[model samples]
Target chain A: MKYVITLLVGMVTGAVAFVLLLYYNPFVGNQSVSPLAVSELDLVDFSYSLLASDSIVFTNDGESHMQPHPAKVLQLWEPTVKMTRALVTILNDSRGQPAGLGVKFSSDSEKTRLINAEVVVDSVWHIYSPEHGTFFVDQTENFWPYLHDIVVPARLSGGDSWRGSWYGITSTGPGALGIARVTGGAGDFADTEGEAVESIAARAYSAITGPVAMTGKLTIALPRQEALP
Target chain B: MLKIFYLGIVMGIAAAAALVYIYPVVDQHREPSLITVRPNGGNSESFHIRLPGDRIMAGVTGSTELTPLALEWPEHDFLANMQTELFKVRNENDVVIGAASRMSGWSEQHGSFVEWVVHLPARGSMFMTMAAKPSADGYREGKLRAGTREFLTLNGTVIERFVNEADDSDSDNVGRIELVTALVGLPDELE
Candidate 1:
């Protein structure tokens, strides 16, 4: 009888622990030794040429499974912006599980999101092909390898007076980033996305139930940072 | 007694699960960061720099915030051509500081062009404000002519830097304005 009680107590304790684990969370574990040999990128086949027409590329030497910071330049002259950049981040769930990123673009200018692709944790990606206005990349999580020519329209041209908004997320909808552009380069960053390549905006982790809509910073200009005194 | 203990254990497990779920929310925090990108108003975009990166802040070019300027347009559209700098936020002698740009609209939709995205170490920022007096020149198509300088040109916002050997006085900080390319101007559609 004592053994039975002890076993019962132990089972309950484990169950309690599991419940708590599912509720509260801790700091997502730090980025492990990225398997990509982050330093070897200089020697690898990764090159700027990776970017094709209407696109740019940022090659990184990180863990094969890690999403790295794409090449990017944050600041530019307001009058004549010549380039653009992308902010890349790897989102991990409470259990430190990567919840893939869903990428999308919208010239519709009607809503804020233009979701077009999904970068699953399995290193697979899905991108919307303008040819059919449909999402592809059914096999890979990383689009960096096979993104083809696409029109990255400028955010605001004197001709269109348009505002292009792009957003990314995972299947669970936990991790996301919204990108906006004003002018030049169609702004379709396929390869290199930003200068001084690093995290541009804040990282948004999804809510527990699922990836809830994020209420993070929308624009990188004057991103509430200490850049300007 | 044994049954009581099991119920208590289950209760404890449930409580713990509840705690775990509420943790991330109670500790809601996000690092204030930004990925500087060229605004493309499109989905596929690119960023040149990550402003507020660790280094830019450490390597202070003596940044300054200039008074924002307001731009005026005509009653009827011309070709979004209007350029007239209002005031100069000077730090010219100050080499490599930061620049900020933001524009406001009165009646029409807020002009997205007013926001300064230039990464130039501004030595000066123009806090401009004025109302445009549009005449019957009527709106032009391609480019605005000098007769009606109403066309917005490259009214570059200048940020003065410390001259090679200029007096390094606090006032020595000065930047010049070289109206680069007003990407989104008083739209050509709007005269």
Candidate 2:
């Protein structure tokens, strides 16, 4: 009877300890909630330059001996586009695991852009856009340099502030490619620097051509939870 | 005593599993930061400029001949213009002090080419030039010159010539000129 009582007491103690350990396990709580729990995302304000030549000069010889012919100037429309706020929705795969994010742009009158999430060999999350290609999110820096994509930490609670820097070229555009790099948060941008080079045809047409440069600040504010519908 | 020992072993295994789950030890794969120079707007011919670390300068430049037209143009009066096109200069802190796309054109007379001189704030200066001409074998021969003049506050000028080449078309002639220079100094923070 003494031995049986001792075994029973040991079993009870072990079972209680096991239960406590299971309850306190941090990994089992929420993996998906920590990264993408935000209801709304603030807009990424971008300031860039649009460079083009007004006229062109073509000479037959390298000298003034031949009459210089003027080439036509190419026109540019809507040189700049500002990315507005987006509604964030978590997307789950067939296994009910967090797969990607479905973002609907507010400025485009509810046009949604799907961002596919991938875990490469590094075990870091890389977000992909069809238009912009794949880019890794530097959680430490809170910015992606290749794509110039910036975001406020979704895990931040109300009134929390964060900042980051980004620099790179846009993958696709209409005119000559523009290079841009910006650092800021909310409605404000700091050290915003970029240049838009004239297209090849435009450059060849206009003997004199250069890039249009721009520098400015951008500022943004996160809407409190109470403001969300 | 036996039960307690078994329970302890089980608890140890569980604890190890939890630790791994909470803080995973993963081998992160990080790609080196690459500064790419794309000349003639062609991605295929673009080359990467190496930036080893802070206070280091590195670059790569190449020139190639395009297909020559069947007709022969005057040798002395041939018009060829080569420009730096675009460049970004960064200091030790990886902050850009000056960035621009300056265009300069000149007729290809004997040994005539456009030269670009850029001054990077609190760092140093860079000089670059590109020149090309048609060879006797109906192929183009080109030359590229690029160098850096670094000014250290305490130290004198540190001049480094990165690329200087003059070759025929049979060599690696990829008709492009790029100069990348990084000077070492603590300049005022870029506003």
In Å, residue A109's CA in model 1 sits off its true spot by: 25
Q: In terms of docking quality, how is candidate 2 classified? A: incorrect
lDDT of 2 by residue, B118-150 (tens): 333222223323233333543322211222223
What does DockQ give for each predicted structure? 0.04, 0.03
Candidate 1 residue lDDT tens string, B15-73: 65565444332121122222232374211111122212211111101223211111111
Per-residue lDDT tens digits of candidate 2, residues A20-78? 45434444321111111232433222221122111111111123221322221111111
DockQ of 1: 0.04
List the candidate 1 regions with Cα displacement exceeding 4 Å: A1-67, A70-229, B25-191
Residue A200 local lDDT, model 1: 13
How far residue B42's Cα lies from its native spot in candidate 1, in Å, is 33
- Estimate, for each residue in A65-89, the C-alpha lDDT of model 1 and write its tens digit: 2122222322222221111112112
Lowest summed lDDT window (length 10), candidate 1 chain A: A105-114
lDDT of 2 at B14: 60
